[model samples]
Each structure stands twice: as C-alpha cells, then as structure tokens.
Target: MKGYADRKDLPRFIAVFGCLLAAAILLGYVEMLIPIQIPIQGVKLGLANGAVLLMLYLFDAPSAWLLSILRILLSGFLFSSLMTILYSLAGGIFSLLVMTLLKKLRIFGIPGVSMAGAIAHNIGQLAVAALVLRSVESLLFYLPVLLVSGVVTGLVIGVIVRELLPKLTFLNNGGYQL
Candidate 1:
C-alpha cells in the first residue's frame, strides 16, 4: 500500500494536500457564486471535483480520498448547510470510491473515471434524499435529471483536469514534489 511511510515524504504530502484542498474550496466557492440553476433541486456543476481528479492522478488513492473528505467538510462549513453537508458526504464518498476503483483498473482515462464518479455521486445523493424524504417517488422523479447533469458536469471537470495536468510540474506519479 502506498502511504506516508517515510519521514521525508511528509512535507510533500502536506504541501500537496494543502494546495489541492485550497483549490477544491475555491472551486466550490466559485461554483456557488454562479447563478445557473438546473431543474433539479440539488444539482450543481461539481467544479470542485476537478481538484479531486487532479489529486487522484498526482497522488495515491488515500490522498485523493483525504482531499475529497476535507473539501466536503471545509466547504460545507464555509458555504453550505448541514443538510448539504450530509448529501455532499454521501455523494463525495461514493464518487471517490468509484473513481479510485476505476483509476486502479487503468482501463479508462480521466473522463471515464470522472463520469463514473459523477453518476455515482448523483445516485448516492439520491439515495440519501430518498432516505431523508422516505419517498421512492422522489428518487424516481430526480433520477433522469441528476444523471444527465452528472455526466455533463463530470466531462467538464475531466476536461479541466486534462488541460491542467501537463502544466503541473509538481505532480510525479512516483511521488509528489514541492
């Protein structure tokens, strides 16, 4: 398992995590500022996911997972409600798991992984919504819209990552560099 086993790796890990966390928070903030509204009640552009995808490619799975969780928590406190936090946790955790698994399989590029994550995120959030509302009808009603939005948002995030990756000299597959 790849991890922070060496003392020398700690600083790089902290630095990378800090940068990605800040980027994720900033993206989340920017997404909030945008007034575009979808028909769905809980769907947004998912711009912060770009940082998650970038971290996944630049670091190990744990780092990506950590960043995802931190982004959810910090962004939630800063810009969203408690309910939003719950939905975000469910969606973000599910999305990260799917993306990490897809990335490990190495059969898909960033777009594919991101799309899977986005779809999974919607499903996860819908599942929570269903539980909270105690209505299967709500899930049925939102499924199509959420799924479509998820794919579009995921593709956008993936494209951003693809464009940004080549220019990020600090990212090394073997390990992160400061």
Candidate 2:
C-alpha cells in the first residue's frame, strides 16, 4: 500500500469517506425510527441508500463499496444483530453492483438505476433467507411483495439522491476531488 505521505489528498479522501459513512449510518438509524408498519419482515424504507448512491456518483466504485461495508458494520454493531449484518451485506453488495453497472452503461438515469438496485437488493436478501430457512418454496412465495417494495423504496431513494446532489455544491464543484 502507498504511504499516506505520498498521497496529498489522502486526508480529503478519508474525510469524504467518513462523512458519507456517517450519513449512511445516520440515515439508516433514522429509518429505524420512522416505523413503516409493514407486516413483511424484510420490507424497509431504504432511506440510507440515498447516501450510498451519492457516494457512487461522487467517487469511484471501490470507495462507494468501502462506504457500504463500513456503514453496514457500524450500523449492525450499533443497532441490530449479526443476521442483520449478513442480510445487509448481501443486499448492499448486490445493490451496489447493479447500480454501478447500470450507471457505467449509461443506459438508465439515476431513477432507473435506483429501481434496479432496489429489486436486486431484495433478491439478494431473499436468497439469504432461503439459505437460512432451507425452504425455497416458501421463500419464493414472498418474492413478489419484496420486489415491489424494493422498487418503490429504491425510486424514493434515487429521487432523494438526485435532488440532494445538486445542492451539495462544495462536493460537486471540485472543492474536494475524492
């Protein structure tokens, strides 16, 4: 690994990473506070995804990935259980990959990418559920509802990111190029 001294912008990079991670975790906590009253076990507002999407757009994939992982770990430790971390890890990785690929392809705007990511995230968690329960048939029955939820939540998150990105002028205007 290169020394921090060799990279003049290492501090800036770390600062962005820290800020985004904090934002992701904080938003995730806020999501927990605002109960959705949904009956399904895995359905979530996914409000934290907005920060992850912003990280992806503002930085490279690797940085975005790190943010996702760190956010999951910290949030898991502070708020939830090991199982939550496992499910989130799976979903977040899947969601990030789908969003990154769609963005790279440039075939879809942020909303399209967000919707795809949302669905992918649910699919990922469903896969984990099937593995844990050893009942594919029962889990398969729950897929559609999760998919629909993912789409709705993902769109909401994407729209939030799109709207917030423009307002963050310091980050967008090259005040910090991380």
Candidate 3:
C-alpha cells in the first residue's frame, strides 16, 4: 500500500477528505432534525457514519480517524453540549477502531463492518454512562434495544455507502480503483 507521503495527488486527497467531512457534518445535522424518540437515550440512526465508512474504504485508517474526530468535535460544538461531545468522542473512537479492524481483516462486507461499528459505538457510550451513573443497571436495561437499533442503522448506513461508492468519480479519477 502506498503511504500518504508517496501519493501524487495530495490536493485531490485533501479535497476528498474535506468533502467527506462536510457530508458527515451535514448528515449529523439531518439526523438531528429527525427527532426519532427511542426509549433509550443516545440512540439514533448514526447516518453520519456513512461518510466515515466511505472514507475508510476509499482512503486509509489515519484519514478515517481524522475525519471521525473532526466530525465528532465539530458536530458536538455546533449542535450539542460538552457532555455530548465526551460521549460522542468516546463512541466515535471505539466505532472507528472496530470498523478499521474489521475492514483490515477483510472477512466481512460493508454491512458487517458497519454493524460492528454501531455495536461498538453503543458499548462505548454505555461504558461512559455507566461510569457517570456509578452503576450499570440502568444502561444494561437498554442493551437489547440499542443492539437492534445499531444493527438496523448500521445496515442502512452500509447500504448507503455501498450505493454511493460507485458514484464517486473522484476516487476513480484519483487512480485508486475501488
């Protein structure tokens, strides 16, 4: 694999990364607009993850990590609170790590990778919540529901990424054939 330093189209890479970051932020805002109330707190479609997954597949681990962190920080600052930022940072890191590992393993498709990411994200948030509450009981009660939501959301994001991949002419033009 060629390193970022070895790439000839650095400008193109930067532009693509910027576009992905914008898409993630936009998706985050869109998700916020749709007030889907679940019984559990902090559970949503995670639509922004589509951009993250797309970055992971089209770019590399470092790129994906950077984008995820930026997305979490920016979105949290713009639309949420400090506490939300903490939870989102934790979840985003965990999710990205899991997704990157799964992607590296090459044993699963986009849906499987996305599902694992979603599950890991929930687990990360739950851990933080448990720590804050000084007990896991309340959060534990919501695990099953969160897991199901994760699966469904992950599948949807994965399918969206898969469909979008073919239409990304920039990636193809950059000489990185997906």
Pick by TM-score: which candidate is best? Answer: 3
Better of 2 and 3 by lDDT: 3
10 residues in a row with least lDDT, candidate 1: 169-178
What TM-score goes with each of the models? 0.91, 0.89, 0.92
lDDT per residue (tens digit) for residues 26-141 in model 3: 99999878866665686899988998998888887788899999999999999999999999989999999999999888888888999999999998998898899998897888
Q: lDDT tens string, model 1, 59-131?
A: 7788888899989999999887988999999999999999989988888888888999999999999999999
RMSD of each: 2.6, 2.8, 1.9
> Which ranges of candidate 3 are over 4 A from the true structure?
172-178
What is residue 53's positional error in candidate 2, in angstroms?
A: 0.4
How would you encode candidate 2's per-residue C-alpha lDDT over 1-178 as one tens digit per residue? 1253476667766776788889899999998888656888788988778888887776667777888889999999999999899999999999999988988898987888888998998999899989999999967898989989988998888888777766664563454221
Better of 2 and 3 by TM-score: 3
| Candidate 3, lDDT over the whole model | 0.86
Task: Provide the overall lDDT of each model, using Cα atoms, as 2-decimal numbers.
Answer: 0.85, 0.83, 0.86
Sorted on TM-score, best first, the list reads: 3, 1, 2
